[model samples]
Target: MNYDDRRASPRYPLRAFAELGSSDREWAAHVLDISYYGARIALLDEYNLCAGDPIRLRLEIPEMQVPEGMLPYLHLEGTLVHQQEHMLGIQYEPASELDAELLKQILANLNK
Candidate 1:
């Protein structure tokens, strides 16, 4: 079976900037696509990452409007599931309610 067929939810293509951090390291990345369960990203620079490595991702979705006093970014925790050169597939861990709501809002805007 295809690897994508294992996904439980559909992915939405998103052209946005993001920061990916693990331990003391951080790298600039571009959001390729996202789903409720995970995301695929391309790093701006080459970096060695193995599957199952913990990663913290902060996505800056410029097209998504947010209410006053709210941040315009989404913070998420995930694990690197696959890698090919500078591109990586990440599987999200369980999210907080706030993060989950924000993800829903982002997806809604993307579907428009």
Candidate 2:
């Protein structure tokens, strides 16, 4: 509950539906928490993720407030940084300006 001291960016708890992997091989995951640089997700299926595997994430949180010109989609190209059981820690690549702004907006809304 106290991730404030360690993370570069504050982590926000979010229960959002997400999709991982490429178009041909996608899996359902629930985003448990998110930050500017990384996220923790729970895989719905039994597939185990390997570290350093290139993956793409597509998250949708319909209830969260979104900034103007920003869609509800949160997409990122990331790598599996760590894993434990059914959960995964993904470190995202640098985001586009639009995505960065959108994430900031969502965090602000969540904090409120």
Off by over 4 Å in 1: 67-69
Across 1-112, the per-residue lDDT of candidate 1 in tens digits comes to: 8879999988999888999999879999999999888999999687877999999999886754564555778889989999888889999853477777888877787778
Q: Identify the candidate with maximal lDDT.
A: 1
List TM-score per model, in order: 0.90, 0.83
Separate clash counts for every candidate: 0, 0
Candidate No. with top TM-score:
1
Candidate 2 TM-score over all chains jointly: 0.83
RMSD of each: 1.6, 3.0
